[model samples]
Target: MTATIDRAHAAARRGPVARAYRFELVKLVSQWRIRLLALACWIAPALFVAAVSRQSTLPVDTLFGRWMHATGWAGSLVMLGFAGTWALPLLMSLVAGDVFAAEDRLGTWRHLLVAVRSPRRIFAAKTLASLTVILLLVAGLAVSSAAGGILAVGNQPLVGLDGHLLAAPDAAGRVLLAWVCVLAPTLALAGIGLLGSVALVRSPMGLLLPVLLALALQLAQMLPLPVAVRLALPGYTFIAWTGLFTSPAQPGPLLIGIAVSVVWAATATALAYLLFLRRDFTNPAHDGPGRRAVTLGVLPLAALVAATVAVVAAAGATGPGIEQDKVQRSVATAFSHLYRLQTAQLNRPDVTEAQLAATAACNKGGGRLDARGPGNDWRCVVTWHLPGIEAAGTAVYQLDITPDGRFMADGDGPKEVNGYFLVRTPTGDAPNPLWQFDGNVALLPAAPKG
Candidate 1:
């Protein structure tokens, strides 16, 4: 009897949020769907690594796919790029979008509300639990993919986006950091899903709405919008990880991306909270907030939308687009690194990047010299000095650049010197470092116009 009383006191001391969070967590874990989702997260990455590693053709289009067979770090980065596009948003939506709505479907809203008198506490508990589950799933995927890649292909140094090489240890640390960075935008995305769950009430609508919204935003990002508008988007955060692999490891743009995502998340969650507090659960017949209440809630949502747009537009007016000078420097630097690697592989005289003296002349479509902004038609003529060659050689590289400052350069090279698609190295035939490569420029706002 004394022990039971003590236990009761101990439970009370743990606080309501803790108790509710534990209860929510237990409920989520017990669900078969959640378990299956966890299982898939664990198993899918391993399978993907094994399957891709065995293929003869490399997935060259993906950021790190060219080196997937060369290093486990590359495989992990490849998966990160792919997952950022679709898998992550869908996975987050599945959990956060259903947490609140499930109570409506099960006719348990009143029971839950009665059990937790404070609606605010209930919201905190469920949100925390859902976020916890998301973190677990992400961690599981990262581990499984990394382990599988290492098992399939031995851990080796990785080639950075700027053509610099990262040793295995440094690469591992960066890979881990990259995944950690993913959580910011992912949480922001989860907030949107949570908002849907609270507002939609119906399980199916709650689950699918966030995913559709995310898809729409992703498509919007592809449009040739103003740089500021694109930068303000939550979807841009997904590609923010690219900055971590650059030569100087610029976190400035990545931090800005995170800030934009945080603003979106905080606003969405606030709106969801406002709606949740105003809702009336007494009427079992009603599935969601009252019509009048919804109208009132929408006023704030609309205001938020307008404010966000205004701020983004103002920023866009001052933000820098992909500039010609930055592109030339970025391409030229990467070309020098690739040239060094190509020469080293051929057992030729060792040449340093400084000795190479690489430079690039870039132009956009319509033969616009010194062209600025993102497009597919950008072309660069890159020239470099090489030992044992009489005159300098030039390579024409076709560049497809994105709004986020990442570009893929495809070289129409002098194959006799640089090797075409494949290079004969002492180790074996490998993808020519100079044939094609990726690069990133800093995305920052320009000086405000006078």
Candidate 2:
């Protein structure tokens, strides 16, 4: 009797919310699934780095995948991008989606309520516990991936998309920053899962609902929706960290990503909190007034959709592609710069701009429309020369320019220009040692047309 009284006294002193929070934390850490997930977060990247290190070909499609086999820092960034797409949502949902539903599944709601006077405190405790788990998991993945990549491939100078080279320390710092940047989206995904968990009241629905929602949002980004809508999506923010790897690092996308993620997370969490407040844990069937509960629930969803439509309408239609004169001038200048870089790598004499005598004739869709703006239909015929190569063979360039004046060009020219070019080294002929400007080239701003 004395022990029971002491226990009661201790519980009373601690307060109901604090005690519930402690209970939730204990339950969360004790679960086998959470343990396995934490272990996987640390071990999976090591295995991935080890296995990919053995491969011959690099994954060029992904932002940093092309350098993974050769650079450890690149490999970590590649893994971070890959994880954001689906793995992150699944990991967050593992605990969050089941946090509330599990209580119902195990018939422990009554016991929990008996221990905790207020249901609101119990709800807050569970949400806090799930969020805490997400935070730890993200930190673990970042550390493991960085450590694993360094161990597997070694810290090498990382090449940016614009052909800039970052030193080992700088590369590592940027890669870690990229990993840290993804936490915004991860937290947003966790909140989504928590909201689903409370609303669905079934473990499986809660788990799969957030995952499906995330997948749908990802697919929507591919559609030709307004820029505002695309920017608002969680998936778009996932890749925003790539900007950190660029020269003069672009922060606009990263800032927008963080803001959008915060809004999404806050909105979802607020809705979940409201729903939990109204829920009747003692009797599963009756959860406040059904009509009023649904109206409140639908408000969040309606707000999201209405905001998307409003932004899309406000942005107006997409602008026309870049002008033809602008494209020709931009292409000629960029091509000359790229050729000079190539020549420098070969230990060959630099080609003068006057010697380049570069001339470009561009057309869009085989002359179907005015080649004035950005589009994939652009094709430019460029003529330039090296000492040995003939000017007779014109380089056929396919260019795609963004509305923001950024462009990527691919040319059907000499094989020497395609992959690793041969350079004159002191010790016989060797492959060009630095990052090649083969894939993408950023152009200088075109001069104002007269």
Candidate 3:
């Protein structure tokens, strides 16, 4: 009899929590709000893909935007970048923020706990349900976007950041990988919404707080903060997937993004769990005074702002810009690569880096100013051979360096070599070839003297 009683008690304990989780899932699915949101997630990408399919020009400012009209895969990646800006956060918050606060709004928390006999169980159930909804939403968006892209644009070879063409199958795999990469930061946003839901106990505050926080962090990135600080923000992680679309696939940024996202999500979820444990759901009046709640909220935000200011102040205002020698070397090397790509497009014989015998001399601002800093007045005189034209020419490049050592150079030279360059296509037609020295290029370090 004792053994039978113990078995019955164990079954009883398991039954309620399982039932509560099921109830939460059912409740979420049954709601029109969630249903509509999920439907929108599925439909929005299709509409965006269709609308942008007709555009003649590519949005090169955004990652993968340059190739959107070229392939359905690129279209999906472009949308992913757009979504990460705000849509991901907003969509995640919509459900996560409401999971707990909705009960408070309905005045059903007491009943919910009483029925389950454990707030812990209810919290777990609701959290699990919210997570399940998020997973479904993410999957829905990924599938719809990928399908829409494939159907509307068709798969084509993608141009990588390094100016190499990625085969269609390889590009498709990377695009899907990029979508998966975004989920890490999306979960962090969900955690923030969950924290707001439990801590604020108001649906509006829960929904808007996370979104506002994300926006604030994004704005903070625009300030002259240290790279480390900027990298720590969840918003920075959103673009880390761009590295995946590059040649040889740089995974460093993606790894850092995942690490930072994990930290933020873990911190927020832990804080939410602790706060939820201490709350008294029996009496709504026991939820504490408004002023005290406001103080608690403001304190953290103020601390963050102060810390940012202090770090910026300590780091000082200057960054090590590109050195003159570096600029000269980079300009020569880049010109070689650019010319090589151009010649290859015309079915010319392979031009060796040695064959060009490229050389460059750089000057800053037409005067003796510091070339080791970012400025628009830098110039480089580059001389290289054009094997196809069987001639050599000197090009004067007007260069600008970014704080991060990126260089953009525009040159006045032979129109054939300067204004437009081509990439070899399988279809034997050059469509919208890249321009040399017309876009951002990384400065190459000076070769070590033997």
TM-score of each: 0.90, 0.78, 0.78
lDDT of 3 by residue, 1-450 (tens): 999999999999888878999999999999998999899888988887766766776675555665677778877877887778777888877888778888877888778877887878887888889889998888777788878888888888776654556889998888888888888888888888887888778637777876887788777755545445555566656766766654445575466567767766766776677677878776875443345444544465455445643543354422342467756766776676656666666777887778888898888867678666567788888887755666767777777665434455665555555644344456565643335343323222223579
- Could you give the C-alpha RMSD of every candidate to the true structure, in order shown? 3.9, 6.4, 5.2
lDDT: worst 10-residue window of model 2 = 438-447
Clashing pairs in 2: 321-373, 321-374, 322-372, 322-373, 322-374, 323-372
Residue 283, model 3: Cα distance from true site in angstroms = 1.6
lDDT, candidates in the order shown: 0.81, 0.69, 0.70
Clashing pairs in 1: none
- Best candidate, lDDT: 1
Task: Show where candidate 3 strays beyond 4 Å.
Answer: 1-15, 285-345, 350-414, 418-430, 436-450
Which of candidates 1 and 3 reaches a greater TM-score? 1
* Best by the TM-score measure: 1
Residues 133-170, candidate 1, lDDT per residue (tens digit)? Answer: 99999998888888888888978888898988889999
Displacement of residue 165 (Cα, Å) in model 2 is 1.6
lDDT ranking from best candidate downward:
1, 3, 2
